[model samples]
Target: MKTSVILNQENLGSVLSNVKAPTYDRDKVTTSIVHIGVGNFHRSHEAYYTNELMEHFGVLDCGICGIGLLDYDRKIYNILKDQDGLYTLMIKELDGTYTAKVIGSIVEFIFAPENPFAVIEKIAHPDIKIVSLTITEGGYNLNEATGKFDFSNPVIIEDMKNPMSPKSVFGYLTQALKLRMERGVGGITIQSCDNIQGNGDVAKKALTNYVKEAAPELLSWIEENVSFPNAMVDRITPVTVAADKEILKEEFLIEDQWPVVCEPFIQWVIEDDFKAGRPAWEKVGAQFVENVVPFENMKLRLLNAGHSLLGMLGALHGYNTIDEAANDPDFEQFLKDFMDVEVTPTLGDLGDINLDKYKKSLIDRFQNIYIKDLISRICLESSAKIPIFLLPTLKQQLRNDGEITRAAFVVAAWCKYNDGVDENGNTYEIKDAMSDTLIRAAALSHKDPIAFLKIEAVFGELVNNKRFVETFTNTLNMLRINSVKLCVQKINSSSTSV
Candidate 1:
């Protein structure tokens, strides 16, 4: 029997012979990018790319210093700190094979709540040229109804009042940039790696708005000094569980508290607009584009929207993982139709990418049986996800008079999913920030079929559209009376394009 050893810098030499560990001297790496929100996706994508650059291309200057802002982040903070910012990244291949690598790109971590000033100072440091973020779709603090930065958040209000002692990302950024300006540090980049379309524009809007209110005097300086670059990042990183750790120990004789598990695929298309400097990520297969909108539109509409469709329908049908749902012939055909029929019409020019192949690849990735991406993870924030992922296609289809049945079915399925009970009467907790409001609205759907659509924050004017209202109400009514599988099969069989 092989002996399991704890994962840290000291044990790097003692890890199993087959597992790849970082070759570069980690002590020599300097923190040049301060990334906020060091979640699984960030570790698997950005940090993974950076680790590659450092390990192979001799790019050690652009090491990442992770910052965790929320109280929930304390768990990751403690885990990574204990492991010396080192952890395993297990990539699950489609053919039931696995590859493991210890990522050493994250050189340090700071839990912002413990010492918010330390985070601000770290960003203010002249060496830190890029302050990147993976704060999720809702982290931008945008008002869902107005689609703009919301200043009324109590935390924002507190940060506005107590600028020096900040809580929110906007506040920390404002204070840090002010310090950098005062100390004569040159301009830096504020790159957003979130899933939102026009994420850079959103970040610029939110930060500038916060600065305009908190310290109007600094807005001009910020405009001159800060750069927000748009990026399209893709990697299906599932939440790490104890079984993941157990697998590492049992198979590889390695112990990791919080190893990241993901599919073999990864893609990052960034706009080449960093101000200070950036890693030569292109060497590691990262695409630096002149404009990321086309790529982002394709990804968000096809891949992300497809995930939401599978998630809502999967949860309703008692399918626990994405692969379980996607492998179903009925669900597979439904997803393909959703991509080819409903979403493709809304996508812009995607340069040279073969749309058909890309769509096919999405299905293949989704069907990766080894990854086991939880349906609940994809379904976690449907309230925020639907508008960004599915609604655009629905709206565009309504204008062009294209297929709306699939998209409408997704919306209806989402409403039904909020009831917190699947078709089998098995109850699962609704995991959303707006669960209460969503559940309350969904509860009214039985009486008033379009009640869930009335939440202006989520559905917008789609609730008022006669065609959409009729289609959505009919689909929602069908879902209330039938099993989710029957609904999926009916939609798949009835669609003309299929």
Candidate 2:
């Protein structure tokens, strides 16, 4: 198929006229890898890296066959198809710098639920060596209480029974594996790019447990053959907006169906284990490390956790965007103090690096106005996010017989925000992240903060800890009476604030 340049030299005459866009033959592209979630994050981070690999190393053998699991994702599918699976990615730097590059790595797009058989056949194809996923935390059938697989979830059970439905990522993958095994096809690497701790292990557990319960023979074959490589992917890609689209079209003179804009900084670290071999990603900027735990911890706990801190607190203060929250003096000081007092000590040595420099860079990243990271978007799914992002630090502080007052303040502020009351004491709709449970808990315990924390699914074993229970209960009570800002001020000014 002959491809035409969407934005030619005449269209974008001067602003970006000197940029020499790389070209690729659509017919030469082959589906060597299939990605489950084709969201903006995946397109900006992994797909872009794969595009660079092909451009620099001349390895166009691998092209992503995009898969959309949810019904809502059909819109994304349609948009990409309109563009012939071609899109431009704009990388925004903290110092007001930007670069635009057109990505042509996705060869074909498929909706798994709409056409299960076709997705399965594509996965079963011998050339598709790797199947990577970024289906978000909620997509996994995890029990809310223990942070483990919810074997009892109805959707999972249905998928387990009717594997051809390919209702879930695990179901689609396992079903494809079953077909591959029957046809004597080699195993593919299961790579997870989610934010969960030990993400690859979690993916492995979900798939293996499901297969063991549903088909023991398949489980045995998977254990013997497949490799689930743990990875850490870092790039902040907020959902696109009209203004962003206008900027792209007016400034760059390109009509992108779904343009992805993200921070220029990107990081990908893998566990160096692949069953059917992998791309030469390191030739670009992707990092391959023996141990990904340290890097994962540094990103998850520090960057992601800081994002949560700004999110809940930002909402409580009536700030719409993360950059807005960073502009407020109280929120700014609260975040820095929380980082210095709470998060810094818990993090181990990060590859002989300066901790102060990392913290400075993180702060600067949060203050970017180009990408309006919505507070509400970040605030959703606190149940899954808080445990991985914030709780470990609190637990570590407890182990050392130290206080997590500021950290406790974050939890209290979040609970108050989840109470279905806005900063003005007006009711607002809360979406996702245990909305019903949190709302009911908040309304029922309007006078008692402890009642809200008793929900086992959200708090889990952490609520039962004597020290944490006392600290959290007291902090919540104080915040309920004095409000977040006042309570935080009191804590920061206290003699034993840290």
Candidate closest to the true structure, highest TM-score: 1
RMSD per candidate (Å) reads: 1.4, 3.2
lDDT of 1 by residue, 407-441 (tens): 99899999999999988889999988789989999
Colliding residue pairs in candidate 2: none
Off by over 4 Å in 1: 496-498
What local lDDT score does residue 317 receive in model 2, on the 0 to 100 scale? 69
Error of 2 at 305 (Å): 0.8
Question: What C-alpha lDDT, on a 0 to 100 scale, does residue 340 get in candidate 2?
Answer: 85
Residue pairs in clash, model 1: none
User: Model 1 lDDT vs. the true structure?
Assistant: 0.90
Q: What's the number of clashes in each of the models? A: 0, 0
